[model samples]
Target: MSAAPKGNGARAARTRGPVHVIGAGLLGASVGLGLRERGIDVTLEDLSPTTVALAADYGAGRVRTAADPAPAIVIVATPPDVAADAVERALTSFPSAVVTDVTSVKLAPLLELTRRGVDLTNYVGSHPMAGRERGGAIMARADLFVARPWVICRDEATPAEALTLVEGVALDLGGVLIEMTPEEHDRSVGLVSHLPQVVSSLLAARLVPATEQAIGLAGGGLRDTTRIAASDPELWMQILGANREPVVELLDAFGADIAAFADALRDPAQTGAKRRIADLLAAGNRGVGRIPGKHGSSERFTTITVLIDDTPGQLGLLLTELGELGINMEDLRLEHSPGAQIGFAEIAVLPEVAERAITDLVERGWRTL
Candidate 1:
């Protein structure tokens, strides 16, 4: 339900009490930091007292003692298997607050909430569509959700006030709002999110018994392909199980593509069939175009790498120098090889800005490679 007409294309202001974040993991901690940065009083809670204290120490937000009163906006960010249960507890723990969950699997949790007779009026389902391979609150960032799509699953019984609060939360976190039915959210994620997990794991699994010489030949392409394999398996098992149906459908489609490629490899005289292989690769190129451009614009980018010494103020000094040079970076990645004292910082910039950045960094006594 839409709020009453108000400002110039802005979400309704937060009218609830302090936002309470549960789980104290990466997503939970990031949410707390983002909310507090927006001037919203945020409190973090976790099942383990020590983890909760650690999150508080990392500035996720003030940790709530067990005896403290419940907060108004309760965000459940636990694993998918326990998200519904956590949501139920949160709703019951704070009856007046608008409740939401940050679980990836939406339909299963929504159905569970409905079946368990949990109040639906003050609750809605949300997935921020962002995460990292690393875990824990120490890795949290306030800008983590910036420009990312935040999926909101709407239902008939979802209260207008609850939607307002959810939208406010996303907006304050710098996330773009996208509304979808729970079924739609599940299907879309299965194609984009779950399918990639399966593919990355399959690729990574092949390297288990490889020789040292073969592993030493690994390049950025293989690194890119298998990066997501480092994700926590326990969390993925719950996600895959929760969205099994949709993910299975996508895997079947992927299997067909793989089969076609296999047939192309075996055929020696089929010219037309070989062209099909080329077309398949071209299709991937086209698909990349469909993804949103950086910062919501149509701009594209290329990445450049700079080697920086691993020492205090090195990263900060590099960033400060880049600012002085007025070079805008699109994206950046830090990489360090085993037993190496220096780290490679991969920075993405607009193609037009690449040469200027390289020249500026070299002039500032920074290595381009």
Candidate 2:
């Protein structure tokens, strides 16, 4: 979960208590809330007085005061642009604290801080690989970081206790700890996170002038590809700008793939064009297969779309029936039936068992689409 704790004293000290979260937005509030859930003392601060109050009101923690004791760790969850400033302030304000930040882009802020000659001793750059499409204290969830990777960037000079303190809090919040240099973290996220955001947003932008009929015909494929496009544009702009080097490199590579794919499809008559298209598409198939869980390669399983009423309890009843049938569903995806009071449950099962599942469902009065 995305909840929290802190550390003080020895560098290797396990998280002690009283985590001061700077920036009471989604990540900060979620950290406070998660820590508070574990009965850890947390203090909240933000540029917006109202935002901090809202977070505190939601039981994240009390609003910070000048009289409060120094925090063992300060989590700077501000936007990437101002992250260095916040981290610098935190390090100066709480000299004894092991300061960490959850900003997306890792290297820029680190460089900025180094440029300012801030002592690198107490500052540890970190980023939690977790977030929601929409962000705010209202969207904060205690379990946001559960099973997600929390990357800690430690230099050779980083003390064992400082690393332990940051890692301990990450563990307390159910994050899987990953150690990386700042450069590695930035490049990895550029490929996996930032590049995709740009692609999805551009793809969704194409639908803006489409006719209602054309748009209404969109299906799961479109939805899956464009879902992240709904993310906060302002936030993404800041992130993309901060990580421009890696993200731009990634976008260029990805754009080349798109151009190649489009050129092949434009005219099927060219020699080797069909094969090029197939190879590119097959590459996508192989890539998708590498992804974890429900969207595994179609070669691994056969999906049967069962039609059913969209009313409450109906989906649960289907799942209950599935268990009763002795059928094991490897994965499942759901889609709505537009303008109809029904939904489609696309259940993936081993090819060997798909026929029996569909037959059994049909026998139990379910329709398949």
Which candidate has the top score in lDDT? 2
Per-prediction TM-score, please?
0.84, 0.81
Alpha-carbon lDDT, every model: 0.83, 0.87
| Model 2 Cα lDDT, one tens digit per residue, 180-232 | 99899999999889988999999999999999999988987998899899999
Candidate 2: regions farther than 4 A off: 1-14, 293-336, 343-369
The true-versus-predicted C-alpha distance at residue 289 of model 1, in Å, is: 2.1
Per candidate, the number of residue pairs that clash is: 0, 6
Q: For candidate 1, lDDT tens digit of each residue in 1-369?
A: 253322122443353547889899999999887776556677888888988898888777898766766677888988889999899988887888888999998999988888998778888889998899887888887767877899998788777777988988887787889999999999999988999999999999999999988998888899988989999999999999999899999999999999998898789478888788889999998987787662322234667788899874887888888888888776777887666789888888878888989988988888977
- Give residue 294's error in model 2 in angstroms: 4.9
lDDT value for candidate 2? 0.87
